[model samples]
Target: MKWLWRSIASLALGLGALGVVLPGLPTTPFLLLAAWAGARGWPQMEQRLLRHPKYGPVIIDWRERRAVPRKAKWMASALMLSSLVSIWLLPAPMLLRWFLTLFLPCVALWLWSRPNS
Candidate 1:
């Protein structure tokens, strides 16, 4: 069980790291997941994440207040819009593009609706 949890935490951390560079990838949620899993299964990993210079502050903000930073919100919205535009430009199946079109906008809307911290 511990090993399984550790694996999941590692995976979440990997995704979170990827999110750092990729617009709309959402680093916070995955970092939170990594933190939760590490706390349960690997304290050292949790501590490492907490100590990380870049990722740590965002997690701290979320922990201290259920607040999403204004910059993050705007970046996410922009990315989602860009992705939606890319989807439209691509010659993918209409259904798939439509699904991405609908999904990304809703996500952006929800992110925009969150209170600024």
Candidate 2:
């Protein structure tokens, strides 16, 4: 059971890392989950996550101060805007478009509102 959790956490973090390259996929939230899961399932993985260059500081900031860097805030905001624009332009269902538009911007806002560290 513990190993299962560790695998799941590692998978989530790996997917999150992949999200870094794939647009519209989230990074921080998944990393947060990975950190949470690592705490319970794999201390070593957690430590590795903390030591990661791209994600480590963000995780640490979130853990210590619930903060994100200012650059991250701007990047998140821009990505959300781009996503919203793509949703509008895409020939998707109205419900799907509305849902993403409403939900993603709110997420961006919440993330942006956090204090930058």
Q: Identify the candidate with maximal lDDT.
A: 2
The lDDT of model 1 is 0.85
Model 2: worst 10 consecutive residues (lDDT sum) = 71-80
- Per-residue lDDT, model 1, residue 48, is 89
Q: What digit string (tens of lDDT, one per residue) describes model 2 on residues 3-111? A: 8889889889888988889976778879988988999989898999899998899899999999988877887788788978987897889999989978987898888
lDDT of 1 by residue, 1-117 (tens): 999889999999999989979866888889989988998899999888889987777777777776778988887788788888888887889998989977887888887777676
Q: How many steric clashes between backbone atoms does each model show?
A: 0, 0
TM-score of model 1 (CA atoms)? 0.81
Instruction: Please tell me which predicted candidate would have the highest TM-score against the true structure.
Output: 2
For model 2, the superposed segments whose C-alpha errors exceed 4 Å read none
Candidate 1 residues lying further than 4 Å off, grouped into runs, are 21-26
